[model samples]
Target chain A: MKIFIDPPNSLILFDLVERFGHEPLSVMATIQERVDNLEIDMPPMNVTLTDVKNGLKYAGIEVPSGIRGRLAVWGPLIDQAEAAIIMEDAPYSFGCVGCHRTNLLVDFLVRKRKLPTIEIDYPRTEEDARNMVIRVKEFLEGLK
Target chain B: MVRETRLVVISPLSEITPDQITRKVHSLGYEVTVKETCYGAVLEGPPETVSKVMQELRALDPLGIYSKIRGFPLGDPKRCRAQHGSRPGFSQLQTEWQSLSLVEKGLECALRGDKAEDIDIPERIPVKDLQRFCEEVE
Candidate 1:
């Protein structure tokens, strides 16, 4: 199963999903593809003009480019996802730290997909941590 | 060459202890610094050495030991939870650490050729129910 994770770049979620025998659809793979292509823009800034055009498919022209740019990357992943894991209230550094608008948009889009999704709060305590894992494990295992 | 840092997490079901893993990592004589963590150990050194050390460590228990590159190097004061009141991504790491045992269990099951069974999960609330709850709150 291809699982889309919110924050798009969370290593924890990525690793866990992969470890549990599912493919994680993360921004890293998308960015890596762009980076690897010499024809595209260079590292640290891999977006091509086509990506900007792709953004229009997800948002209106009036919306900020950053949000659109992010959706261009994330929207497709959500569409491809069979399931999703969304970590709520994570610190800015936990994953994609760019564009709060983009984050919210991504979250709303994933939830709207109505896929087999697990929305978990960022754990602040050891007990919360344990429960978070158990819930994630259960959710992933339950998926066909 | 740029130095690399990695967090190696051992499964709770693993026969090797963190302390034993730490000593084994040290015995490898790599230029790496090993720090035994509650979950496993953190290794900091040249990329090649870190990779080599991690490979050997994983061999100890193929399905029980896992590692990932850490964004920050060990003892990076600005990002260290010990120095700073709290590290930016420490909570995520903590949560991940706690989950390693569950991952180990799943891996073992796969190794034993066991089929995945459906586990009961909480169902999401319907959109209408959520809207009604919000309206009542208001």
Candidate 2:
């Protein structure tokens, strides 16, 4: 299945659609695009964010205790994602220290549950998203 | 004359000559200024262009390149050290340490393998400690 990983409403979503074939979109983007197209509204978006926020608070993902409160507030939706379009220049993965820390929880889930995975080449600029998606499409094409 | 920063290449007298260095510097669009310094030589231009010229010069002779040179704004040496020392990454702990009241500091110090009573402290208490004390008394 083609995957579009949307981590919170960040640019990685667009990059993912660029990388993987966009036949079926990621759930988060579908929600955002739906909202944009007037099919959904802010009320539903707020509700979804709240639900994801609460779910992550109780998930018991560990970091230093000092950082946990902030993480619990911002981390849930990102952590819950089964897949993602990791940006090449993002502080986390490309060259940042926090990259592995953010991916640690989900990586564990993939190992234990045998989740299908795709690691897209990092996209550096907004314009690169198109090429990134095409690359993803080529990758999926190879699978077929 | 517009003052521009550029990298000046210097080498030991035995290594390279004025003519050879001048040709390389000119090719990189830098005018060699002083060529007879003990270390090597100097060039002048915009800081970025000078940096590129410097890199090229370094590549031309690796053993002769003693330091990575770049330009930055100059400031008061003491104030610069103080301002840099106050950066959040390092000064945050100091702030936390200072913000603690004598009792809290005592408590923290005690937890860290020191006797709370043994630590000498002045009597002024922080409002946070006073509020905590009031709550306990109530």
Best-performing candidate as measured by lDDT? 1
lDDT of each: 0.72, 0.37
DockQ of each: 0.11, 0.01
Clashing pairs in 2: A18-A132, A18-A133, A19-A132, A19-A133, A19-A136, A92-A99, B10-B40, B10-B41, B11-B40
C-alpha lDDT (0 to 100) for residue A12 of candidate 1: 60
Error of model 1, residue B95, in angstroms:
10
DockQ of 2: 0.01
Candidate number of the best DockQ:
1
- The sequence of per-residue lDDT tens digits that candidate 2 reaches over residues B3-95 is 232223232322555466657776765543424333344455444665566567657654333221212112313224475542121232222
Candidate of highest TM-score: 1
- Indicate the DockQ of the complex predicted as candidate 1: 0.11
**TM-scores of all models?**
0.59, 0.27
Q: Compute the interface RMSD for candidate 2.
A: 24.8
* Cα distance off (Å), candidate 1, residue A93: 1.8
